[model samples]
Target: MSKQSIVLEPVRCPDCNQTHIVKHGKSAEGKQRYRCRNSECSRHNFILNYSYRAYLPEVQQQISDMAINGSGIRDTARVLKISQTTVMETLKKKTLH
Candidate 1:
């Protein structure tokens, strides 16, 4: 019997959708991290899958949507099961961009 290596598609830069990625390091939780070579990319470093739900893009968008719908910081935090400070920080970053 022989072992075979599985081939996977190249990792892409989520922001730029570019395939020029290099391994940066491992996260504290042991997930692999990647860096994009695209100079125009804003978010350079990222993990393909994050262990924490709060760092997800969908969750961040939900936080913004809830805020736009007149939801309080505590309310959004409670609903998302994330820290109140995280909700505020996400909103701040969204407003800045």
Candidate 2:
């Protein structure tokens, strides 16, 4: 059997949509984080795998809708199948922005 070579492609920057990026560091969950090389890019670093439903756009919108609809934190967490802490954190971040 012959040995096969695995080719790895370079990751692109999500902020600037540029192909120039470098490995910044690993997250607490050991996920690889990348930093954009473009100095003008707003976002400095980002992770590929979010590993949380709260990070999703739909989930974010739902969190806002649930809050506006008078849904409790626990209720939103249950409906979204996410933790109550996650629900609270999502809402908190939204308010900060």
Candidate 3:
């Protein structure tokens, strides 16, 4: 009987969409995190899977849109099924950008 070997591909940077990545370290929850080698990339480190809904791009955009539509922070959180704190933090980051 012959044994077949599986080849694993390296991870890519989500921000720059580049393959120049290296393992940085594990996250607080022990999840694997990677560092982008692309100097021009804005993101320094990221993980493949995010545990929080606030980390999602669509959720971030919704937080901004809800604020623009005059929705309350708690209302947005309820509609989005996320915490009110997440809604506030998302909007705060949007303003800084």
Which of the numbered candidates is closest to the native, going by highest lDDT? 1
The regions of model 2 sitting more than 4 angstroms off are: 1-10, 13-16, 37-42
- Number of colliding residue pairs in model 3: 0
Q: What is candidate 3's lDDT per residue for 1-97, written digit by digit as tens? A: 9999999986878778999999999988898989999999988888888887677666788889889989999999899999998888778777733
Per-residue lDDT of 13-79 in model 2, one digit per residue for the tens?
Answer: 7668898899999988898988998999977888877887576667878999999889999999999
Residues forming the 10-long window of minimal summed lDDT in candidate 1 = 88-97
Which candidate, 1 or 2, has the higher TM-score?
1
Candidate 3 weakest lDDT stretch, 10 residues: 88-97
Give candidates' CA RMSD values in order.
Answer: 1.9, 3.3, 2.0
Model-by-model lDDT, in order? 0.90, 0.84, 0.85
Local error of candidate 1 at residue 6 (angstroms): 2.0
RMSD of 3: 2.0
Model 2: worst 10 consecutive residues (lDDT sum): 88-97
- Flag regions of model 1 displaced more than 4 Å: 2-5
TM-score: model 2 vs. ground truth: 0.63
